[model samples]
Target: MRSYPVDSPHAAGRILALTMIVDGNLVGSELAALSRSKILDHIDLDHADFQHLLKDLCEDLLTSTSHGAIQVDNALIDSVLEEIVHPDLRRSLLHAMWSIADADGWLADAEAVLLTRASNAWAAETNFSSPSYRRP
Candidate 1:
């Protein structure tokens, strides 16, 4: 898939969309946690619009699957992370991803893999200087 522009209006939604799609499927708890975070508000999407965005993201996954390639590239993740100019937003994005992964009360192997990729990608993009600073 082609990458979106860093300043695209959908950039923030894309981040959340990727978080939801990274594990290849969305669970009820993850969706609930995402909703609770009011992420859609930040993206200027209401619930109905968010549902449509989710559908679009799922379609991209389906298309990738049909091509026999269903993986999310680390480079793509880093590109997404690069769009977040603010350190706090980057940290928040990482935290939200972890929350999604743990929402089911158990982090699946697939979820863990995606979360690690995202974390490493974000760190690489940000060039984090402090080893002691943890996600807030």
Candidate 2:
């Protein structure tokens, strides 16, 4: 599993976000519920799981990025960055940021900056090495 030291700057917010994404998919609630719960009421992490699609999205991004272990398909990172490439996945990322920013349930200035930076970074990475769509 990709390991970012807990001491790394902003690591907790990022990891917490990822965890919520992976588990939230099953937990069927929100990031808050996903984090503080165990044994989701009715869900499974394996057996025709979400990883297949999640992996490709991450590999494609990482193949073009220097984000490395901190953002690769490392099981931990997969929980979040796996969806970095999909427009549909933004919800979870946004929600996670919302969670982080609103630990007090109210967005803060720095948290807004963090969310904006993360969103831009993820979006920018997607375009860096992507081949332009061209009918061949």
Candidate 3:
């Protein structure tokens, strides 16, 4: 998979893209939820750029799935999550991911695993001493 610079908008968009496809299908509701979240604006990524990032992610996944199986293990996830070191960006991405996961009204096992992994990883990396720090 192509790697973006740490904390770059493309890196952030990649994580969001993974969230959209991890469940094996990208539904309309998930896209709608992403649009409503306005996370792209926060990350300084426009819709067009985000779409490009999504396409890149899909291509990478497809290329890696030569055996007819897509392997998205925790180590791969950690590598992606490691790109976003900013606490605020991590929080925003996490919230957007949750919104997308729940948008279809049924959270699949893959979605739950991704969400939990991201939340736990980010939580451990961030200092939660501030009173304003809240898990999204």
Best by TM-score: 3
Give the higher-TM-score candidate: 1 or 2.
1
On a 0 to 100 scale, what is the lDDT of residue 66 in model 3? Answer: 44
**Over the stretch 49-75, how does candidate 1's per-residue lDDT look in tens digits?**
667667776677667663686866666
Which candidate would rank higher by TM-score, 2 or 3?
3
TM-score for all models, in order of appearance: 0.72, 0.31, 0.92
- Clashing pairs in model 2, backbone N/Cα/C closer than 3 A: 102-105
lDDT ranking from best to worst? 3, 1, 2
- Stretches of candidate 2 above 4 Å error? 1-14, 17-91, 127-136
Model 2 global lDDT (CA atoms, 0 to 1): 0.40
Per-residue lDDT of candidate 3, residues 1-136 (tens digit): 8999999999999999999999899999999999999999999999999899999898888888747999887788888989999998888999999999999999999889899989888988886348786878
Please give the range of 10 consecutive residues that has the lowest summed lDDT in model 3: 126-135
Model 2: ten consecutive residues of lowest lDDT: 39-48
Itemize residue pairs with steric clashes in candidate 3. none
Better model by lDDT, 1 or 3? 3
